[model samples]
Target chain A: MQTIGKLSAATGVKVPTIRYYEQVGLLPQPARTQGNQRLYDRRAVQRLSFIRHARDLGFPLDAVRELLGLADDPDRSCAAADAIARRQLHEVNARIQRLNALRDELERMLRHCACGTISECRVIEVLGSHAHCQGGHIEGADLAGD
Target chain B: MQTIGKLSAATGVKVPTIRYYEQVGLLPQPARTQGNQRLYDRRAVQRLSFIRHARDLGFPLDAVRELLGLADDPDRSCAAADAIARRQLHEVNARIQRLNALRDELERMLRHCACGTISECRVIEVLGSHAHCQGGHIEGADLAGD
Candidate 1:
């Protein structure tokens, strides 16, 4: 058994994130020492590593939870996991397409910019007038998160 | 003169988001009626529309604020706006590249998956073992937000 700090070090997940995982039921509750310090075993290490890897792969927490459930039950069909991955892949593709459109629009705006005063700036002009836009680039775009 | 609801309808910006813009100083405080209703003028409509357009192009709030400042001053050089657009383009390109890597990784995982039992699942196996990863695909990835 290792302390929570050691677990964090071993897994490369922050201490608070580990606690959060536990709170969210992603990580199982670990044992504790007499002094009430958290103690993690090898299983905890493996579980945390799996969670981190899934998160790194851009899997949402809900999908990760579903995957963890699937991982726990080895006798179950792998179809569920495959479906989840496919859905994530679709979302990623959609975001890439939207970003590409934005890129094209930005490129077009820059190309037309004279780099003169702001009054004559193509960048400002295009942004100020939606009619100048190529259209349909920003629908359902989560720009703040992007 | 128009009410906040009218402004929202005109600019396609939500009422709460308009208030948020005001709170963040992106939108100037509007005149108010004796009945305590927020009243906006034609300038407010134009300003909000500019903000929406910039946001649609995936500019961050800070960048939007800077662009708004530039727009408000017609005599200033447009170089700053040009630079901001370039920076945003660079970021979008970086994000696209990272997302492509993720897409490649996911495709690889899916292609190898045989639709067998979970015990033989490539997805679970690969996620369980980071060594199976192509490496560096997940570095600094904002998967949760992505």
Candidate 2:
């Protein structure tokens, strides 16, 4: 058995994040020592490492949960895991496509700039006039809060 | 002069978001009517549209603020606006590169799967052993709360 700090040191996951994972159902509630301190085991270390690795790869928390579920069930087919990974891949691909479009637009705008005043600036002009853009819709165009 | 609702309708920026932009100093506080209703003019409409278009291209709020300031200063050289756009382009490019690497790893992981149980699952195996991965470090590997 090790203290929560030891577990954090081992897994590189912060103490608050470990607690949050437990609250969010990602990590199971740990055992408590006589002093009421959280204690973790080797299994906890491994599990937290897995979660950390998945998150590092930019998998959303829900997807990481799904992957964890699959990991816990060794007898289950790998189909679900594949599906989750494929879905993440698709999302990444879509983001790449959108960013590429944005890059091209920015490049064109920059290339057209004659280094004049802001009134004649191609960069500002492109941003101000939607007609000058390629009309490609971004995935999350609305930054509005509910 | 137009009401806030009319401005929101014209710009496709949600009402709450417009208010947030005002709160963040991204948008100027419009004059209120005798009854205390917020009123915007044609210049506000144009300014909001410029903001909306810049945001749609995935420029961060600070970058949007800079772009707006440049737009407001017609006599200033376009160098600053060009720099901001270039920086955004660099960020977008970096994201694209990271996503591509992720895509390749996911594809490789999927390709090696033999559709076996989790004990033999390539996906889980790849995730469990970073040695099985491409050895590329992911940026922002820590998901810890500050």
Candidate 3:
């Protein structure tokens, strides 16, 4: 059995995050030592490592929860896992499209600015009046766009 | 002047969302009619349109506020407006990079899956053990060969 601190060291996940995972039920509660401290095993560490990787991949907590559930059931079809990954891919692609639009608009506006003094800058004109925008990349709510 | 419904119709923004914008101060409060109905004018309509378009471009409310300020004062330095746009651009590009990483992983996992029985599915194998992932798009958590 490994202490919480050791689990943290092995998995490179923060102790608080591990605790939060347990609180949220992402991780199962571990056994307690004689000193009343939590004791984890190698499997727990492996699971923690998996959770950390999925989060780093930008999988939302809800999606990660689903993935974890699927992982725990060895007899389950992998199609479900594929489906989740596909959903994530769809989201990522949609975000890419929106960001690409934003990129184009920003570049066009910046190019027009020519770094003129703030008073007469093109950036202000673009932001101030959409009528002047000749239909360039200006777009949707940032968060929703993603 | 128009009623809230009319304003919603004109801007194509949902009534609750309009109210939310108003509550958040994105849209200024309009004069109320004797019957307590909110009334808006042509300028309000125009402002709403601008707000919608800026939002479409993924500008945050805070940045939109600054943009509105710049738009109102033509003489203000356009640099700030440009800076905000650039900042948004940077953010969008960063997201694109992350999304690409996710895309690569998902695509590879899906490809490697041979529709094998659940016990031997490549998809499950990839997700169950990040160790199966060769290099390239690594999790931000750095559990590379461990």
- Every prediction: chain A TM-score: 0.93, 0.88, 0.88
Model 1, A81-115: lDDT tens per residue?
99998987887788888889999999999999999
> What value of lDDT does candidate 1 attain over all alpha carbons?
0.88
Residue A60 in candidate 1, Cα distance off native in Å: 1.1
* lDDT digits (tens) for residues A14-97 of candidate 3: 899899999999999999988899999989987887787777666778888998887778787878877877887787676666
Q: What is the interface RMSD of candidate 1, in Å?
A: 1.8
Error of 2 at B22 (Å): 2.0
Tell me the docking grade of candidate 1.
medium
lDDT of each: 0.88, 0.82, 0.75
- Per-residue C-alpha lDDT of model 2 across residues A80-122, encoded as one tens digit per residue: 8988888877876766677778778788888999989999999
| Number of the top-ranking candidate, with TM-score as the measure | 1
Q: What is the per-residue lDDT of model 3 for residues B12-109, given as tens digits with 9 covering 90 to 100?
A: 78789888989999889999999888999998887787677667667778888888777777666667788888887787677667667777887887
TM-score of 2: 0.89
Listing every candidate in turn, what is its Cα RMSD in Å to the true structure after a full C-alpha superposition? 1.7, 3.2, 4.3
Ten contiguous residues minimizing lDDT sum, candidate 3 chain B? B137-146
Superposed Cα deviation of residue A68, candidate 2 (Å): 1.1
Off by over 4 Å in 1: A144-146, B143-146
Q: Which model, 1 or 3, shows the larger DockQ?
A: 1
Models 1 onward score TM values of 0.95, 0.89, 0.84
Backbone clash pairs for candidate 1 read none
State candidate 1's DockQ: 0.69
Query: Of all true interface contacts, what fraction is found in model 3?
Result: 0.50
